[model samples]
Target: AGITGTILILGHTDPLFLRELLEYRITQTVIDKAHGIQLDAAAAQAGQIPEVHLKIDSGMHRLGIDTRQPEDAAAMFALENLNITGIYTHLAATDSIAGEDIAYTRRQIDAFNGLLRTLQGMNIQIPLTHMQNSYGLLNYPDVCCDSVRIGASLYGMGSKEPHKSNVIIDLRPVLSLRARIVMIRTLEKGECFGYGMMFRADRKSRIAILPLGYVEGLPRKLACGRGTALVHGRRVPFAGLVCMDQLALDVTDVPDAKPGDTVTLIGRDGEEEIGIVDVAEAAETLHVEILCRIGQRVATVVIDE
Candidate 1:
């Protein structure tokens, strides 16, 4: 935990949160709204001017000062005691390769650059400027910047359909989700399993019970054979409805699977792998959401290889 690198908070800011940031040694944050500027000014009056990066709303319109209103940003920069170290904007549609999306991204870049030029003419020089997210960096590498914000791609979980992008990188996944098989049993033909008897075995089937379910962030949408996991180096389908704290896998094909064997839910196991993107698709969500929704009960083991 001895990380000496700069930590920047990207969420909305307030007076209380500003003080909390200082206590935690988080000195830099993104200022995206008029309220944020006011908070910084108030902090300055209190003799603690926090380092901030101004965010411009070129097209996303989610946060940041409006691109058309450069005067507001200029005024914020002119405020005394404020350490405005960087400026940035969010690219709205750099994830798509569609012609319309491409043009829209270009317009966003142009608008952001125009604002930078305007600031330059007014003798305002923000030391750093960036406008690229993961897809932005991949699709618009020509739009140079001081830093690129890589989120999903940092975990090698970029767009599942990489063909939609102009650039592709061979990034390896650094995270994995695994669980131990807690029980193994066989259901005779016509026997029902799980809540609501969602699965009625058509044949005598061997299933492995896992200590993971919807409560552990396994999407309920994956219930009833929609999702799979790797057991004994083979893909095994979800055998029944995913319960609150447990689920079963149809390991009839994986005859050697047993209790205590490691089940790969989102990682490589032997020659088989269950990627996060695959889970996302089967769960009808994004890989980002899959990663974020992992329950606190799951132990995170950090391995450096």
Candidate 2:
């Protein structure tokens, strides 16, 4: 775990969290507003000067100082307690090639560049500058800077659908979700199963119970045959309502499926692969949301390959 790369926190700053960051030697963080500047000043008064990157609100309207008021950010360079190492902005809609969205992203880039020129006119030299998030880097590679802030793309995921973006990278997924089949049983043709008996077997069927459900971030929307899992290298449909900690998969087609078999919920099995995007599609949400909602109870194993 000796990763010595710079670990910059991209979230907004607060006084209490800033103190904790300083205490842990994580001296670099993003300053999105005047309040964040004050927090850094207080830390300086306490004998710690945290390196910070000023974030300009280049049309995201979510965080960062306003682009119109470059003076507000220029004033921060005077504060000895805050070492302004970098400056950046977030591009709101760089993911879409739609005419309006493209124009909007161009405007954001222009605004951010305008701010940088203003700061340069004041003779303020920031060591690093960047504005590209994952989508921005992919779609607007010409808008380059010292570094880029990539999130989803780092995990081998970019667009919800490949057709939505102009640039596509052959990225291999670095994460997988798997569950063990705890039990397997046969359901009679007329039998109902799960909460509210939402699923009834129309044929004599074999089902495998997995110790994973909504509590584990498996969307309930996938219940009642709407979702599938890979068992013995074949697809198996969800057979009943997904419970708090359990769900049943119709494994009748995979006659070799049995208790203790591995279920690929979001990963590969033999020639079959269930990507995170596939899970997100079935759950009617974004793949990033699916990745973020994975419960803490689920174990994460990092494979070095």
Candidate 3:
């Protein structure tokens, strides 16, 4: 937690947001999306500009000026009353080692580096430059100039499927999602469960109702028997459709499960662990998406042991 670097604000911000940033004295910002005109207007309204980092479009085609276009790049960099403290870009892909996206990532880094050299030759010095994302930092550490942005890796999600990385850094996932079983009951054979009565009890079934649902960021497919949770250190299958505020789980196998018992949705429970990647795979989505879908209503309880 002993972080001692500037927190860069990425993307264009509204003038009001910029004013708030000024009021808070948070001035280290990146002007990655603004052209000369937008920067002038926003910075004028926000008062004195902070240390600015120019964003260059090396290849992503999203934000940043094309440094290859000399006239355009020069015009933006030469704008008055604004300080250009650094230059940066975003890598499109660094998760691949053999695809065109990987090759394009290298090309983008090359172009950005070349632009830096050009700027140096022209006596325009940028104090900092950062182009690497989490994947880029792991795969292309040498090219990660000035600084590296660690996004997913900061949360121990550094790679895609298989959830493995060759990076030298040691990472341990620390986030976990937990819920409580609010109700437990026994269902007779042939009894229906949940909306549309999608799941039918084949035998005497012990079920547990959890006060968690898609609204709380649990994947809806779980209710369709796609995902599993751990209770009493045993695996349990989800039953029927996930409702707006509750989900049912087949806990017949988890003989010890009961009301108020803890459930591990995406976390470790004894020897069993359900990771973000695991949930993503079950939901047919990305790990980042799974993480972001977590609703704001859920309280974040941190454990630092």
What C-alpha lDDT do the candidate models reach, one value each? 0.84, 0.83, 0.77
Q: Tens digit of lDDT per residue, candidate 2, span 17-44?
A: 7677676656454555566667766876
- TM-score of each prediction: 0.93, 0.93, 0.88
What is the lDDT, from 0 to 100, of the residue 110 in candidate 3? Answer: 90
Instruction: Write the number of the candidate with greater TM-score, choosing between 1 and 3.
Output: 1
Highest-scoring model, lDDT: 1
Q: Whole-model lDDT for model 2 versus the true structure?
A: 0.83
lDDT tens digits, residues 195-244, model 1? Answer: 88999999999989999888789999998888999987889899888888
Which portions of model 1 miss their true places by more than 4 Å?
27-33, 159-162
Root-mean-square deviation (CA) per prediction:
1.9, 1.9, 2.8
Q: Per-residue CA lDDT of candidate 3, range 216-271, in tens?
A: 99888665678888898777888998888899899988788889999999888999
